[model samples]
Target: MLQTAVLQWPGRWTKKPRAAAPPQFRDSSQPASLTVKSPKLAVTLEPVQHEDFSSLVVSVATTRDRSAFARLFEHYAPRIKSFLLRQGTDPAQAEDLAQETMMSVWRKAAMFDPAKASAGTWIFTIARNLRIDAIRKARRPEFDPEDPAFVPDAEKPADEVINADQMGCMVREAMAELPDEQALVVRMSFFEDKPHAEIAEQLRLPLGTVKSRLRLAMRRIKEHLGDRA
Candidate 1:
């Protein structure tokens, strides 16, 4: 009976349904570049712009952002260093001054405003004030008016004072006769206590040339004031 049922079975076969592809995956052979062009999948990039000190200062004060303060420090510190250097300060001292200036800026960050002055002008003023203070401190000497060694009780005669004033005038006249550049170097070297090498560096001249120029200037002055001393 079983054999007879098998013999009567249908000749056609039924097909099974296939599973769907995953939502994220694509066919390996297909190009992925075409899929990225879809507007919904595209990424948009914006350009980055740099901010100046005024803008950075406002941002730091208003937003309490440390990065903005850093930007300002980076911009001004080197300029302060150069200023000190041009004033005849050594690199180490100039760097210290620059650091001090930057510290002052950080402390006074709240005082900065775009309308009052530019960052460069503000920092230059701070450096200028510091330099004046330094000069004053250097020039201030302890004075004992009555000290026997330091002060003389008897004043010089009117004639002697007149002679000294005349000598000073003659020296000034002699200096005025010198070529402008040579006179400037000599005056700065003598009156300002600037070393010859420093003067040379400041004026951007060779050290030998500075020495030769100074020597010539002194010789001329001595000739002009012959026997005056």
Candidate 2:
């Protein structure tokens, strides 16, 4: 009786049939239908032309232009930093000195007379004064000019002095090989301790040209002395 009942219920009648899927479905393997493209940007930097301070100082002081002050800051900030560094100041202190120097320049812009001193000389003097003040405030021992005990060690031997003289002569000869303009300014600035403006006036050259000549001379001197020193 059980076999007869199972036969009557067929396997197809017991199973559930799935409904058909909708026809609009698409395959996932294919790429998306749309894409986006961004346009490339072109960057252009305008050439910057710096005004020469030697020429602009009179105008800047007269007009009191903020741009001129900006130019001054740009030029002297690094120089003051370098000056302080040379004096053995730490970086933070040197940065502070530079800031102080710039502040002084801003306040004293009216004092900047191109006729009296070149920009470099004016800036150097500011740094030098600051350095002097710093040294003075340290309260180091004061040297007595008349005290024999405080005098420099007795001069080196005559032979050593002669040798030094010979080396100096050789260095001078090397300096003689420099261009006349360069050598002349170097000698005046270094040996005579004359300001660049005075040197320029004496040489009948533009102050900028005088500075350029002196810089070239110094570079040459440094190159020549490198091995000797």
Candidate 3:
């Protein structure tokens, strides 16, 4: 049996036999008979042309439209509940979390801005955030301040470290392949961190000549790097 309850402004708790289309929740102006489907879920989600769902939210915020809010709640509650259940939350807790998530939607409706995000996107984010908080609260680990191992290690992704090492190797190999004069200018400019003008003065080369050599070295490096597919 499927039952949906709207707490703030109550709606009839419709009941249906097993294997039925999802519940119907009508908006102030638009009634939703949404049919939402995914690999993990197959629920009723009537297709309504929402060229502008943001406007629907506006109706609720400005006019206190219960119907408008009801439509959003009915459509999303099951989806949110299912998502939480998939994450290993108990059935009772999942239902409660879904209700709380929709309740938050109603409370925070006035803050919704169409310019920033669509109604669906905004509501989904709210559900996700609430789910995270609920899970964390449910499974909070004990911590002791005096424990030496209590300090969490900062983790850099292995891929990022590997990429950095690869780039360094490429640069070294590229420099080794460069002519003596070009390599010297490249090294002083990049490795020694010397200014181009200073390098020109120290090497007794004109400024334009130094810049031209550095440009040539960069072009060679780019060529060595080759184009990605």
Candidate 4:
């Protein structure tokens, strides 16, 4: 099974005793909670160290803990597969990509830095890059230079060219003003011509989250343009 393959990975024979668990995180004297809100439910997890799943990654990195890696795989694999399916991948290919994504996670576990991103974000990034590579590979046919669609467009007047450059600069400035998460969704939905559902899946966010981010981004962009005008 792919799950078995993923957990066993390359260093299964290492017999190092599992290290003692890390100290618990706390809010003052109380255990800190991590809330994960999905479309189906909102669950508040008990304060385990690194409730964001960072500790599991650390364990995998430092101890070669198969159980920790297995837990991470179980959490991320389905999400990655669902994300690929929404990006128009066929079922079989999506499954393969998901497996590949997990394998990469296993190989690169030692490189994970929780200070930069959560475990989920890092894993999804790998999935996204692999998807892009697969898409590029599948588009290998050479361009037909003589095809009518390849005909050059009429030259634009100097004034029109200047106006387009100014507009593009303004758009870029507006995008730069956005928070990273909002800017990402905006690029996926508008710049890349992907739908909100696809954006949500790829980002491992809820549908409402994608829509709200788009709405907020548009409003902010409009405000920036208005100020410039």
Candidate 5:
């Protein structure tokens, strides 16, 4: 069954909540920014097409468009529930968590950045995190605050901190030394947090090519960081 209870506006629980006003968009004549990875590693953010799911999320974020939220709820709730069920959650819990996940989407809509992730990626990440949290909570045991072993660890020594910083700089320098194609995929997969398939689609490369580039990049980075790593 579709979980419609959390889809309604707060304090307005009903079988069918009233639809909100349609989302508004800026004039099409104006330039919009959307970040995309170019062959040269240059980035320019083109405007997302209106039919894109990212645009729907943007509508909800910018306008508090209940209609857009409803559409998102309708689309993602079932998928999230199924995802939870596959992870071994009880059906009732799955249904409830699905509703909670959508509610989180509604609340955290403003945090969604299309430049960083596709709508499905961002939404599913939330669902996955909620599931992980549920599992952890269920398995966690009570702990005493006075337990000496529970104390936080001491801060790293100054030398260790300096070494870590130097290592990070070296890693970044190594990344810069990569060929443009390899570097582009590395940034997309690591910095942008995109999956291999999404990176392949965005770059218009074969899946094998993407994997090959990543593998080559990792090998070079490892070679560069040899002793330190």
Candidate 6:
């Protein structure tokens, strides 16, 4: 599976470890906890060891740990696939993106600095950038050069759109501004645009409580956004 996954990667592997008598592997049993803090959002994670993939990413980086990488893929690839599907990507393409995204994780794991972002956030950013690339490749000029209505544009390239990275950074900043409980709910809301009832169920919170927190979070985000609100 690792061998198959490598082929989907955009670049060659920079590191590949030889097998050893005493294998180096991440403690899969360790409860993962990832806390992402920023100037705009202050989310507190309730998941074990921040959902376990951050350290797995670090392990893949340092030791070229295939076992750890496998765990990471098993956990996140399906979620990535679901996200792409929700974004209107074809199912087969979404499946491809899931593998490709994990391959990217393997290639870019070395750059996963926990201090800057959690493993989940880092991986999400990579998937988002890949999606952006996909979108740009599909974008064609709306106007034909031979058309009489065609006019040369002075600024903003035809393909220029809301940058996924910049928007993600802004969202993280906005999330950072929310109180812990609100931020946590906001994060879940961001996931697949999950409904509040589902989020409440996952967090074991009352549905009304979830709705109320979301309202408060939206209010705070609007305040920070001004006209963008």
Local distance difference test values of all predictions, in order = 0.55, 0.53, 0.58, 0.59, 0.61, 0.61
Clashing residue pairs in candidate 4 are: none
lDDT score for candidate 6 against the true structure = 0.61
Error of 5 at 7 (Å): 32
Supply every candidate's count of residue pairs whose N, Cα or C atoms clash at under 3 angstroms.
0, 0, 8, 0, 4, 12
If scored against the real structure, what TM-score would every candidate get?
0.38, 0.39, 0.40, 0.45, 0.40, 0.45
Model 1 agreement with the true structure over 1-229: per-residue lDDT tens digits:
1111111101111121011111132222553222332343221222112226667766766787788778878777886775565455567876887888878777776776555455655677676666555644554345686677875546746543433234444455566566545555664553233567766665567799878878888888877666333
Q: Write the per-residue lDDT of candidate 4 for residues 22-132, one digit (tens) a residue.
A: 112222235323222232321112222334477788788899889988998888898787666545567788799999998988888887877555676678668877876
Per-residue error for 31 in candidate 4, Å, reads 39
Per-residue alpha-carbon lDDT of candidate 3 for residues 115-146, written as tens digits (9 for 90 to 100): 54567667777866676577655443457757
Would you list the clashing residue pairs of candidate 5? 33-45, 34-45, 34-46, 35-45
Q: What TM-score, to 2 decimals, does candidate 2 have?
A: 0.39
TM-score of 6: 0.45
List, residue by residue over 186-216, the lDDT tens digit for candidate 2.
6455322247886566555779988997787
Model 2: per-residue Cα lDDT at residue 84? 57
Better of 2 and 4 by TM-score: 4
Instruction: Write out the backbone clash pairs for model 2.
Output: none
